[model samples]
Target chain A: MLSAGIDIGSRTIECVVIEDGAIREIRQAPTTFDPRGQIENVLAGVSFDRIMATGYGRNLFEVAYDAKTVTEIKAYGRGARHLFPEATTILDIGGQDSKCIILGPGGKVQRFEMNDRCAAGTGKFLEVMAEALNFSLEEFGPSALKAGKVLTINAMCTVFAESEVTSLISRGENREDIALGLHLAVVKRAAGMIRRLWPGGPIFFAGGVARNSCIQHLLEKDLQVPVIVPDNPQMVGALGAALLLEEGA
Target chain B: MFGLFGSATPNSNERYGMTIYDDHYLGGIEERVIRDTETARAAGAKVVGVYCAFTPKELIAAAGAIPVALCSGSDFPIPLAEQHLPRNLCALIKSSYGHAIGDSCPYFRATDLLIADATCDGKKKMFELLGRKRPLYLLQLPQTSATAESHAYWLGELRRIKVILEEETGTVITDDAIRKQIRLYNRLRTIVHEAFLLNTGPIPLLSGRELDTVTSVAGFELNLETRIAEITAALGEIKERDKDDDYIASVAGRPRILLTGCPTTNRKVLHLLEDCGGIVVAMESCGGLKTVGGLVPEQGDPLKNLAANYLSIPCACMTPNKARLDLLLAIIRDYRIDGVVELTWDGCHTYNVESFQVEECVQATGLPYLHVITDYSENDTGQLKTRIEAFLELLN
Candidate 1:
């Protein structure tokens, strides 16, 4: 039997198909203005017996395709546990929102917290700050890691932080230092949410934001614990949905 | 078939239990009451507008005046209110002040006098401004309900309010009148409380949205007898439908949620919770079970009884608010609640800070808890949905 899971996020869509217990195919695409069209493009030739949807646009996908839906929190918990069986805590920072989930003994969500209607600690904040500082998204993380010292950024609002960055630049502050400061701000927010849920432990960090090396390094250093990142962080939700279907959950 | 409030008639085929007392009927009643209030006011009937649950409606009834809730629950007048009030105030205060100054809200327009309780700083300062536009009376409520001096001060405030009511309505408020109003209000509260308790059964007869509409409309009804009859009939319909095996099976396993926090006047969070597939079996807010759960002593001094009953309301404004935590734990067990969702408005510092103790209390009972801080706006609906859905996942 084959199972499929599609995570339709605000910025991207990830589709994972698994046969029996092994991954068969993985596909992804940008979720442009027309998400339905983008979703159709992502699943062009994927075939599966059972399918599930999870993410911000899961309800729309459920209605349009008559498929089952699960919240990203549960999907991430299950996905993280499947990848690392001993994982008890997970932090997922997607494009528009971030969440901290603590799993029970059997990989059930015990408690969770998400950012409240803001882009302060999510990948979108990093993307906006990258543009303001004239750094490519690819180069943003490595450049921040190369800074000698970190500048302090107090504003959590994306718009205010962007202006703060600009002023710092005009004052002849090092660009790498400003980038490091912004990364530190995001890391502080994510760390605060995780700390609120769990004590010191290895955290399974998964999402598009986890791809940024600066955030991962700062998170591990600041929290004084290992931050585990899977090979394909963005596909965790999709993989979890598919695995849940395989388990007949 | 009123056009102003849309159709007051319910589509017979909507849902099984809610066909009798749905939003259409409740909304129609609101429109009719507004028109009826205008006619009565022109004929020399006095109307007293109140904002908080602390305002003793029985006192208004004893003074031979109509009591109407003037607390605004919409986002429409907020922009107008922001012109005078700061944008950082609670939405409830902003909306209430906006409706008064903008010449909107028929309930505010029909009032001969407005009464406000000094519950929070935002509301107290806003009442000072509201006094300029209308004949407003402020009740100096003691912050704590734990002291003998506070009780005496609250009783004195009630007595002063009685004098103001008599002077405003030109009617003598005797002890006999106060006792009669208390008895009538006690009966009303009992029926409403019973209606809310109907959800405690294995399967809820009415959804949270339907229950909220019934209670909100019942709050504004001038005729206690009429309100009691309407709600009693609705309860009968729900009870009869609860016996259906198919209906019970259809809604069997949804997680039951208990809401506790600031008054959910706007119902944004309530709608989001139900929309995310969880059943809000109980609400501990002002407009919910909190106001109706307690009753006044019939044999005691009527004025002192009114003061004591209203003072013990367990609102966040009261320091040493241990009563609220106790009430929440009782509701959680009695309602068989699977989780607790506490919603505090953005600027409501009292409830916002009190959420810490509430969270600790809920987690102690081995139930999951979620604290949501938001305003009456649609900007965060997407984010709120994800949070609510994920919270429900914990229950599953």
Candidate 2:
């Protein structure tokens, strides 16, 4: 049996196809203000026995296959359990938000902490910081590991943080050190969320931006846990959707 | 249909007083009320309490204190807030001066100490920001109370706040005292909640927005129980709209959205939302319960009752241990709400804290959320009209 999954996010979308528990095809796209056309394009050439949608915009569109949609959190948890059974805590950071999901011994999501109210500590936040430091998000996570001394980025507002970053820049601060400072500030925000949930782990980092070495390096250092990133972590939500289709199938 | 203000409407009855909602400006009503509220130095009302409707703040009365609604003092600015929070933080915080600490307004000289709580993140920081004053009491709340454990945790915190005030104010808070206050408060709350009830019930003399004024101002008076009793009776006499009036909505956001920076007087804004459909049967706002009055403290260690009432009502302000907006949303669910018109003020970071969370929650409730960014001033009709038309266009 063939199955298809669409993961609509606050800022991006992903679609995956699976046949009898084996992966077939997957495509990812930015969740724009107008993503329907792109969404249709991503789902192209993907004919399936069943179609399921999930995430913030899961219900926005109708697909050809029999419809079933779950929350992105639930899908992420289920997918994580299937991929990395030892992932006690699944920290999925998407475009507009980040969440800390605690899994029980049974691999079910027991307790979760999410910061969706503000865009202070997510991929978009990272993207803005990237622009401020004259680096790509691809360089954000690792750039921090090279820091000699860490500085604190004070502002939570993206605009304010940029200005702060600029002032520090004009002050002739070391670029790598400044990047480390920013990485710390954003990490502190996530750390606060994790501290609240108080999850036990081998924490799993799953999201497109999670691939960044700076976010990963700092997360592992500050958290004192092995922060594991899935191969193609961005597809975790959609992959979760696909796996759920298999389990029920 | 005629507005559910009063009986004998239109040109038919000249004596029919207008509902405050039938107004040219929100600040105009506030100005009128503030005008009624003589300055503390002039009023000579001994022992007043600054009321923020996060919880029952009547405890100050039990301590032989008077309750005052902590509105903006014309002369004061959020110096303390600016010290810690950004300059672009909301005006409510900027103007939260004097209320947290004494302000230039003479109304503050009467305040013995400020009582506050972290019902939300913003208010939590407000308490921290205001902590420089040292006399404030900040209460904390659980994020989710749906579970038995979380409920007990929050309720236990509420109980602890009662104890702390007993120690600080030296007001003996007995069970009888609290039970009595709770009964009176429960009555007031029920009545006030009923007024905003969307299920075709008798509209209380106030709406959620108006509750802020009634509750906050009425807390200061000595004869609160009597005043509330009289007001409750008056509210009963007011008319209830025949059918489900207009926009039945669920107002959601971070709890501490007090401090009215801008005054809104746009019925078209309300009407546009209504015409878009759904009478705004309920919402959470400072102009609502935070200032509006409710909860009659049972005549007792009046101080404890004051504190108790502050703990009960919901606030959009970020107060500790308070999801006042969340609680309000749960209460208003009986009205069968369809959408939410999140009327926001520009530069109001307080409400922005939970705006997105609120939108997501409303979507979970199977409703659309219309983010109507407006200032307290009701002059942005064209912008509001466009936004409302575009947003409402989605619901259709």
DockQ of all candidate complexes: 0.91, 0.02
Top-scoring candidate (DockQ): 1
Across B1-396, the per-residue lDDT of candidate 1 in tens digits comes to 111111111321244534546556566776878888888788788988999999999999898889999887899999999999999899999999999999988888888889999999999999999999988899999999999999999999999999999988889999999999999989988988887798887777666666676677456877889888888887777787677785576457778989999998888898788767777888899878888899898987999999999999999999999999999999998898999999999999999999999999999999999999999989999889889988987898
- Per-candidate TM equals 0.97, 0.49
Alpha carbon lDDT of residue A107, candidate 2? Answer: 62
**Model 2 per-residue lDDT tens digits across residues B118-171:** 554545676676667546666565544345564555556657766766666566
Q: What local lDDT score does residue B257 receive in model 2, on the 0 to 100 scale?
A: 17
> How big a share of the true inter-chain contacts is recovered in candidate 1?
0.96
Cα misplacement distance, residue B44 of candidate 1 (Å) = 1.6
Per-residue lDDT over A87-164 for candidate 2, one digit per residue giving the tens place of the 0 to 100 score? 878888878667777776676655565552456877888788888778877776677778899788898778888898
Runs in model 1 deviating more than 4 A are B1-13, B20-27
Every candidate's lDDT: 0.88, 0.58
